[model samples]
Target: MTSDDSRSRRIGRRSYLRGSLVGLGTLSVTGVAVADESGNQCPAEEPDESEEREETEESNETEDQEEIEEQYETVVDVVEAGADPEGNESITPVLREVVGDDTLLEFPEGRYYMDEQLRVTGFENVGFVGRNATLVPATYHEFDGPQYRLFRLGTSDVPGRDLRFEGFEVDQTADETGIRVISVEVEDGLVVRNVTVRGVHDSGTWGPGLFNVTEPEGEGIVARFRAEDGAIHADETPNAGNMWRGATGIVVNPDHRGTLVFEDCSLGGFPDNGLYASNETGRVGVDGGRFQNSTTASVRLSGTTGRIRDATVVVDDDPHDSNGQHAIRLDGGDHELENVTVDVPQPNGDAIRIMNGVDSAAISSSELTVGDRPNSGIRIDPTAGATTLEDVAIDIDGSANAVRILGEDAEPVVLEDVRITGDATGTRNRHAIFCERSGCQFVGLDVEQVGGDSRRGLELRGSEYVVADSEFVTTHTPIVVNGGDDVTIEDTVGRSAGDGYSLRITSDSGAVGLAGNEFPDGVRDDR
Candidate 1:
């Protein structure tokens, strides 16, 4: 009536210290064997499959049976129970074991305090399960490396391969990261589920969270070799470096397998970014999570085949950086964020921004706000990336401009059904869109409101841009095509640009594409 699969593996399996007691640092050994419960050659437990015979007897038709069930009999213990080796509750010798190949080590609930680093290496399919177990690092400025990343996996032992980390609570409360993996040597698969990394480090500003993906081809290796096979002279963009240069959180570097799953996790209150995955890190699927309250941004991502569905990203003033940076400052390649909400609180930083290096990132049905920053709400500097923001709300609590587009490699950026609104003062704080770079287009847009900031409605630079079927109201200079080439502004409506001017086009340069623009008092300010 019962199958062997119904039975569970016990924790306290017999373990022997036959491998020359490697101490606590890093254990390495070969051909080491242990005895069974009877102190003899190790024996494998046979499963009683008698129940399968009964199932076959009852059915007339034969279906494929389940494959052999290889259950991992994990060794578990509590930290307090194994605190003092001399005491009744001391760490079991089984845990300190180097862990044979394909071993599952489970720690019971409690705190473990150790001076040096505790490593698990030279293992495959190794499972480090922390069931209410906390690994506390002793010092701050004194870890194995520069970034006081407390813990590591897969060191000198061919790098821990195919590892799974689950139910572990790392103590990064006062430091930058709770746990840090130095390098995995070869391509390794890592799975981190149900974990929390908290605390704030002021010194770790440029440090990004959930970060470090390898660069497919940067400028590092080019310097080491001479010009040959189109390596150096091809992209001439002098390589930067190699693999997980400077970052925190789940990092994968150097031509390897990098895939992450963030299900029902929270990343906030960090000094810099919340979830940052970049540099040739491919194919990440993120569903359902809250990313907010970081000093810099909520999610700064780049890579290929990324889908962020059903999430909320809030960007506010950083207590550390009063300038209020972008809430979601990014430069990604072929990515999509659907059904997402990006809110920038009043006096908020840029809700969404794109700087350098991006390609084909689509933002659909999202919200972008310009809360309290003095700059634009959404700013795109320069890149050859094809980006789109569809059915979006650009609510500028009061930035001079709501969206600013720059020039870089003559890339094309699109805004469809985009709504821009701001406070009504109109004396200054003008313009809703500023086009800097060449080749940009905006369609199906609405603009309203004003502020006293002497800003323009829309500013254009030395780039080819197209603005069609748009409405604008109260503000200084509604639309102005500044320094750019092949510029087009048409089918647009504006209400007020307080005192300075309604629509001013100075910086007289480049071809202007002006058509169907409904700016009543179009002023060309020479100043």
Candidate 2:
């Protein structure tokens, strides 16, 4: 057995002992019941079922770890295999000759230089681990043809299984420097972690990383992979004629067919979109990352079913040759955004846009804060499917609608426990909830709009709507039913601080049902 296998076994034994001890302690505490002095029995202790379950779970986890460690039977140190460690010579030739299947390639405490891409394909159970190692790539002019990437692990047609690449720093701070550090296409069980790119990408090449899982049952994770300096525009680089808009931080394209998770990654202001994983057929998850100041969007995701949870997207600075910047954009999927925080202090577009053709979406327990610009906080496009906004809060400092729902023929939307508070100061009429869709339900809504006289609270323009248990406080009319059929406002409160009516119903409106609602400034029924 190899030293790595021995070490893994020892670690697994320790983990198992630790878990057993923890389970025993829990059992000792929960298996006994105690009473107070007054003879009132404490809550009856159930059987110690959780202790057994915990022990089983820990044991299974240890087994999985040991299995992974044992697969790398052969270990090769690249420096020992006729490769230079001082960054004076290219390691690409040695890597091409020494890389093999079921091997662990180690780089120990050195700087490796490469002027060409190192391509590997159709290998199983391969790993590249680094210890205090740095990789320096050739500048744009000196790199070989198709100067896009440093390492191409696998291709879609010839994918490797069970790959791991981690623990290295990429130094691209030299003049005219840029390269895609690694592009990995795997069939199953891929892990890429702790690879930090340290500099701005100025070579007008591809982005720092691209990853994909090419099989239906495959799973992959890219964690703590940071490129915080980001990239520049292509026109400013020596390779300007070959590329467009410079590089993006990371990309996952449409050929991906399995589940991929990006966890705790940080990306800076790239010229194009940051973490653009749209147009994929499988599931993609962005969990706990910070993506900031990309041109089109900081985090744009689309797939069959996916989510963006506990992530932060900020657009504090405008990109060069600035275009619209959406903090988070979701397209063509059944997705959810939970516990997300989007702060666009220099907003150029909507904070969160659910684009057309989305099957279904939900935004829950998220906070969106937009600056003093004329962009909407959340915009649901006209052709999107059903959506739900629950436990969400929007804070706007400009004349933007808190929630703009467009599509008159779209599916029903539900907004429950949502809060909108901010100043609407523009000349145009800005409503907190601007709904043009039919068959929508608004429940437990708290909306407050201040500043201009055109700042209304809720404008419902479609048919078959219900507004229940909502409170609206605004400068203009709080509730306006301009043209809608079978609209009901029950158990709600509408208050206007200005001279406008608290509730207004235009003459062209259809049948309206009002039950147990309070309009402090009175209602104007022109019908």
Candidate 3:
């Protein structure tokens, strides 16, 4: 049978079995049947490999969901526990009296106003479930916490474990200055879901995000949430002339360890970094999120083994166009970024800045487009260890370099199947890729029009380099090795515009070998 017909037959069989198993009470015990009641054994049925795999995965997922749901019991309603949802009274004592082990505090659809910071500490398996309920913080003068937080989950010294805070919105717009919405310092088993914080944060010494996972231990997840500061953009009313108040959307500090997952979350129009996961001893996973209009880096993650998958960072038309804003900053970790998209419309922005001390990084299937004069699409800083950028496309619209590797190191930095385009008219960009570190290999590179103001397609200034199977179409020069030793340029084809040479080597380069390179006028040692 054809593959399609076989797939259909398998699907139909699985569907029929699923429907039958729902009503077969006796057979449901084992999820599979064997014998008949007539004393005759039935033939053993061969299992469909794909069908069995999918079913096993789904069963495990359902078991996890069921286990989580069975842990917490809805015990008390905040309104019934002397909480005045009409925005008048203090619910601190009432909320304290209602919470217990494995208790879920249910807040109905109403706006709860708090003059003082609503604090919860040292509680296990305690949760907050709200249905369209909002916690509105009073003005900065009326609020009580010296920390200026709307909700404090756990203290710094004393941590709470097995906590869940979900389905609530915190309004910090009334106090225009920076104010943290939720500050969580938990030990283990924490979940923060579907929480929204609205306002421009401008109060704290170092601006805090809407949700701050300060010192989490073990496993925790923050999903389906939004933390936005509307005024940090171009058209909104500035906080005070320049309204960027160093606001972060979601931040995890360095004290956190173990696994912390952020899924389906969003952070927009913040002054500082958005969605920061920086822990020296932890592993962070950011899956499917959008970080936009950040003044500094959009997402900065530094962990033992960090991952950012299916994430998008946008720095388009930000009003306070700062020079040091990096769309995504990977610092101090062996991180893997997959299927990430970065769009930088501002001039002085870097799409991806991999800082020093990172053990390793792998970025695959990612696209970066920078407008105006952004710094670089991807920058591998000094002291960074082995890095691999594969199947990545970069487009620079202005005078910025597409990829830049700085400082000197002997760790292998590999670029495979990478396409970089500098598509500007009057002010063409610099080199499409600039390398200054040793031990690097470039394979399958497609470069176009990256030489403006006497730049090159690829500029190398370090030793032990390999450029093979690469195509370059540039304005001024194609490849230039200013200060490098043991450089090999093989299997490369390039065309330089105007009267500029295809390959130019300065006096500082040493021991350069050019073999199998299809250039117009061979290699010119300008030394």
lDDT of each: 0.49, 0.82, 0.69
Please write out the lDDT profile of model 2 over residues 1-527, one tens digit for every residue.
Answer: 77676556434433433332222222122222223345354543343545544553464334343353455667788999987899999999999887887787888899999999999999977878777899999998999867899999999899887777878999999977789999999886677878999999999999999999888656677878999998899899887877768798999888787777787789998888899886558777776789999888889888776778778999889866676989988878788887899999889889999999688988999999988888899999999999999999999887878899999999989999999887765356468888999999999999888778568898989999999999998888899998887999999999987887888999999988999999889989999
When summed lDDT is taken over every stretch of 10 residues in candidate 1, the lowest stretch is 219-228
Residue 46 error, candidate 3, Å: 25
lDDT of 3 by residue, 217-311 (tens): 24566766777553353223223333345456677887676566676678776666777776776767776678887666778888777778778
What TM-score does candidate 1 get on C-alpha atoms? 0.65
Q: Which scores higher on lDDT, 1 or 2? A: 2
**Model 3 pairs in collision:** 177-202, 178-201, 178-202, 178-203
**lDDT score, residue 271, model 3?**
60
Question: In terms of lDDT, which candidate is strongest?
Answer: 2
The TM-score obtained by model 3 is 0.80
Question: How far does residue 472 in candidate 2 sit from its true spot (Å)?
Answer: 0.8
Give me the candidate number with maximum TM-score. 2
- How do all the candidates rank in terms of lDDT, highest first? 2, 3, 1
Q: RMSD of candidate 3 to the true fold?
A: 10.9
